[model samples]
Target chain A: MVERTVRIGSTHGLHARPAKLFTQAAAASGAAVTIQKAGGAPVNAASILAVIAQGIDHGDDVTIVVDGGDESAVLDQLVELLSTDHDE
Target chain B: MMEIKGTGIGQGVAVGPVVRMAEALPEPVDRPSHLDPEREGERARASLSVVAAELANRGAKAGGAAKDVLEAQAMMAEDPSLIDEVTKLLATGKTAERAVYESFAAYRDLLAGMGGYMGERAADLDDISQRVIAHLLKLPAPGVPNPGHPFVLVARDLAPADTATLDLDQVLGLVTVDGGPTSHTAILAREKSIVAIVGATDAASLADGDTVVVACR
Candidate 1:
């Protein structure tokens, strides 16, 4: 498994639209991915409900773990997603 | 000649027959399943898949912002995390309908607990739960009604998924009993330029087929 920690960038945090974009990308990657707040239990990253329920606010640090299916590439893409402000 | 007051969205005065949207389905009973775990799991999966596909199709047809809202709802229907919960419940011999209900309710409560915009999202989960449960039970899914003509819609509140697919021409106006001006129903009404009055809790007493005048300032 490969993991990267990044701060959420959306101005309003991981709400529906941003959460949907992130979860859709994660599900499309065909990789086992999980996301969690720093020191929080990881949840399936492909679940929009789980992601939104985390209440990940802007600048909140989160760790995403990816296993199999081009781990490095998927991690890079998702990391970029987290670092960019989607609400802009 | 009842005077129902609420915050209006967009603007217009429309007069038409009232078409009441169905109430949300009752919570499923948590009874043990007579079918095997595998069979119950299959039933749950089938309903979820069907609901997901239907949402996706409606999203495609909807286009614009409605498309995004519907697409997100579709994702919720087949969310792998939710499926895992359903599967676990089935393993415990729960009926497919009850399993789906409890699983979605868990997330619903979590999101609602966040309050504000997140709390609004709880309605989306509720809509999906109703669709899946309706499918499992072979019942009509409660949502925007198609009464075969233009009408003023009345409901507790409109879910985004319902608003996304609303036939504007067919729905002359909207009166919701349980939504504030910032609710998804109001937002969509503004986006689509539909006349709407939200948070008119008194509107609940309005009966179907009652001709009412809806005027938005």
Candidate 2:
């Protein structure tokens, strides 16, 4: 399993549209990916409910876990995705 | 005999007794010491499956995107992973209620945070804020007097999501629990030419099925 930490950059943190977008991106990876807050149990990264349920806020640190052969590529893209906020 | 006011997010007027719509929290299940964790998990899975099936049937009757979302939720509520998690917690001597409480804490916090975040970006932020707050309001303890088919909805607040879900053709006016200038509900109501009132603290106390009028500035 490979893990990475990223900060939320969305103006609204990770709610509604942004959450939907992020989950879609994660789902596209085709990897068994899970996200969690520090000390939180991993949840399905592709489920909007699970993602929003993480209670991530702007500037909160989140750990992403990917376990599979393509873990490295998935981690790279997700980290890149989390780095920038969506446009208004 | 009196009128209460709130901002209206959707256009049009509806008159009826206020009927609060809120989901009930699930009750805790008792487990016997003789039951193995795996067996207990199967039981939880079965119960969740029944809930999901019931919700799916309800969604089909509802017929809309909202209905689709409910269907999706039913699936989540039945997820094997969710079942396993709940079972694991129960196996550790945690009561079902306690487990659900702990698990939902994160979900609740997330929703609250999301509500706050959405509020800041909202073009009509105030109305959305009001609606978000309404999520916390308790339905009248003794079945919030059914506003026997409310002709107009008087609320402390109404959010965009709530407005989106409401059928505007049925509402006569909207009164809010909280809101001020720049409330999205007011703006939207104005666009729809729906009568509305805002910033009324006692709006929720109006008698069920009372006929009232509103003047929107």
Candidate 3:
């Protein structure tokens, strides 16, 4: 299991569009991905409900875990996405 | 001539022509040969500031936690990158309306594409609604009066973003192009005793402004 930690650069946190965007990238990678806040139980990366329920606020540190083939590429793209400011 | 029903989020009864405040549709313009990049950039900044100010005012006035979402949208609207994009479009000789439209279109498409992405993984209505609302926020404001007109508001559905900005003084009734009794607009209208109907595709074709009486009952 490869784990990557990234900070959400979006101003509104993971409540709306940014959450949707992150979930999309996770789905596209087609890996068994789980995202969780620090000290929180990870949930399915593909489920919007599970994600929003996580209540991730802006600037929170989240650890994304990808367990599948080519996890490196998926992690790289996701890392890039999370680190970039998507306040738009 | 049917009086369909819906939930009224706000209170009030309106009877006017059906003035459609759909997406702002602007015609594309030819590119200018002599460009003033600096001036155009300032203009973009100025226009976006106006939109941002309105968004901020609305966000502050929003009545619930959803207000946070509106505030976020205001921030996005004021983003430097968007201003840059608008400025570039105008410098390319596009009209103000054209630049604004194209910039908003790009955000809309991005949000919609993201919605498509989430829709594939989650089929729940709430999930879909959130994504759709996010996309709507990315677009320029779709200012629909809450009471709309005394006429019925005809739409695909009353998106949360659309519902958020609705003025309670203009709507009399509603006829949606799509949606059902369980939809947000229906539930709210019903609660407020506002008449609303859904699932009528012809609602979009109605040309009446605030003067025509729409009986969706």
Candidate 4:
């Protein structure tokens, strides 16, 4: 498994629209991925409900774990997604 | 006629009879399932998919901002964490209705407990739960009313699902008893330029078929 940490970049944090965009990308990635907020339990990154429930905000650091597929490539792509401000 | 007050959205005046959103469904009973867990799980998944598809369909038709909101709601219907909860409940011999109800309720309370923005999201979860339960029971999906004519819409609060597909031609104004200025109801009203009064606690007394003028400056 490969893990990467990135700070959330959306101005309003990972609320509805941004969360939806991120989860859609994650679910489409075809990798076994989970996201964890700093000091919080990990949850399926593709599950919009779990991700929203985490209430991850802008500047909050989150770790993404990828256990399958092209680990490095998928990790890098997800990290890119998480780092961009979707609200913009 | 009595005048009630709330934070208004947009500047408009409308007079019409009231058409209240359907009341929330009763909590599903916790009776043991008569079927095997596998069958119950199949039934639950089917209803979840149906509701998800319906929400997405509404999103597609509404377009614009409502598209994203409703699409996210569609994702919520099949969320893996919630499905896991339902699986556990079914393993305990709970009926699919009760299992789905309790599973979503658990998550709903969790989100609501977080308060603030998260608290507001609890309603979205409740809306999903109600849709799935209604599907399981083969009952009409609970949401905005289609009274077959022009009227004012009054409700405790408008869920995004309800607000997204509102018939602009039929709904003259909106009155919500429990939402704030930042609620989805208000936001959509502003976007759509609908006359609205939110947090009008007194509006609850306004029964169906009651005619009233909603004037917002």
Candidate 5:
């Protein structure tokens, strides 16, 4: 699995809209992906429900893991998604 | 009507009828499930999925910026961690309604305890919990009131879902008894250029049809 820790860029954090966008992207990637807040348990990144339950906020460090299926490319796309300010 | 002080949103002012959003459903009573744990679990799962799907549908209909907010809410309805929590509660013989309520409350308390931006999320959790419980009980989801006329909306606060579907043409202004400048109610008001005052604790006593001035300076 490939993993990267990135800071959340959405000013309002990873609440509803950003969480939905991130989860939809993860699910579409067709990769086994998981996300974890700092020192928190890892959750299915593609499950919007799991992502929002984490209550991740702006500037929070989250680790994204992609286990297979073109890991580098998928991770890069997810990283870009996480680091963009979707709330703007 | 008596004047109430709060942080105003935008620079506009409006006056009209007062229509209050329904108060949140009362907390679910803590009681053992009359049905077996498995049945209770099934019931809980069904309601969760139903609420989630409804939210997703609303998102699709809303489109644009509101679509994202509604979609996020739909996710909260079916979140994996939340399901785990509800299942655990069900295993303890709790009814599906109580299980969903308590499970969401656990997360709501967690966010509220965090304070600042996270604290504001407690309202979101409350909104979700209400949706799930309302589904389980076969009740209409509690939200914005349609009094069949343009009115000044009064509520404790406006959830994202409520604000997304609000009839801007019918709403002359908004007044909340509890909410800050950053609350969802405030954001929607500013975004739509509607007059609003939030965090006016005194507004709690305002009733339906009350006439009040929303002085935005």
Candidate 6:
């Protein structure tokens, strides 16, 4: 599995809209992905419910894991999604 | 049959049946658990995990904006910090029901006490807590009703979770007895272009299936 840590950039954190956008991207990547808040248990990245439940706020560090299906490219794409402020 | 006046959200108008959102359940009594602390803790964990999984499943089916809200709610159901709180209460010999109730209440109070954005989160916490408690007791989760027909939702107020999952195509309008124009309910109505009347104190008397007209002058 390939992994990367990135800070949440949305001012409101990973609330409804941002979480939806991120989870949709992860699911569409056609790769297995998991995300965990810093020092938190990992949850399925494609599951919007699981991602929002983490209550990840802005400035929080989260680790993203991507396994299979062009891991590096998918990881970079997810990392960019995490770092962008979708709330704005 | 009577016209009630209040602040209307957005310019749209609608007419339909009224469906009331269920009220929050009363707090669980601080009673000792008949079961062993270990057993009660296990029960609490099982309920929490079940509710979490259920929320995730609902989110998966919902998609769009509703998908995100449901997903977040699922996370809240099994939140590590929240689970920690439940475990601590159960260790003290509290019943699983009370443990879940108190744990969620603690976080709800904390967030409500913070005000602003955090204050808004308190409602979400309340919704999750209710769902977990309902699961433990085998009761229907308290939320917007699906009467199988288009209706106007009347409630004391709408929580973020309730509003997020509302079926817009079926909801002709919204009316709340409490909450201001800036409340989450109003904002959602405005965003979705749904007709809404908020802070209608007299709306408290509105009953289920009561026909009402929502209009703005």
| DockQ score, prediction 4 | 0.77
Judge candidate 2 at residue B149 and give its lDDT.
46
Per-candidate DockQ vs. reference: 0.83, 0.20, 0.07, 0.77, 0.49, 0.16
Query: How should the candidates be ordered by TM-score, best one leading?
Result: 1, 4, 5, 6, 2, 3
**Residue A4 error for model 2, in Å?**
6.0
Across all candidates, what is each one's fraction of true contacts kept? 0.80, 0.17, 0.03, 0.73, 0.60, 0.17
Each candidate's lDDT (Cα)?
A: 0.91, 0.56, 0.59, 0.92, 0.85, 0.82
What is the lDDT for B105 in model 6?
A: 83
Evaluated against the true structure, the overall lDDT of model 3 is 0.59
lDDT by residue (B22-124, candidate 3, tens digit) is: 6433334445525366665555566566655765576577556335545545555554344566777877776554565566555545444455333322222
Model 2, range B20-124, lDDT digits (tens) per residue? 333233333444335565664555455555545754565576464435444544444554344555776768765443443344343444455655544333322
The TM-score that candidate 5 achieves is: 0.84
Best by DockQ: 1
How well does each candidate superpose onto the true structure, as a TM-score? 0.96, 0.55, 0.51, 0.95, 0.84, 0.72
Sorted by DockQ, highest first, which candidate order results?
1, 4, 5, 2, 6, 3
The global Cα lDDT (0 to 1) of model 4 is 0.92
Q: Write the per-residue lDDT of candidate 6 for residues A1-88, one digit (tens) a residue.
A: 8999999999989866777678777878898899999878998888654565567899999999999899999999889988999887
Model 1 over residues B1-217: C-alpha lDDT tens digits? 6799988888789999999998877889988899999999999999999999999998898788888889999999999889999999899999999999999999899889999778878878988999999999999887889999999999999887788888988999999998887888988899888999999989999999999999988
DockQ of 2: 0.20
Question: Could you say which candidate leads in TM-score?
Answer: 1
Which CAPRI quality tier does the interface of model 3 achieve? Answer: incorrect
Candidate order by decreasing lDDT: 4, 1, 5, 6, 3, 2
Candidate that beats the other on lDDT, 3 or 6, i.e. the better one: 6
In order, the first chain's TM-score in every candidate is: 0.97, 0.88, 0.92, 0.95, 0.97, 0.96
At residue A30, give the lDDT of candidate 1. Answer: 98
Best by lDDT: 4
TM-score of 1: 0.96
Count of clashing pairs, candidate 4: 0
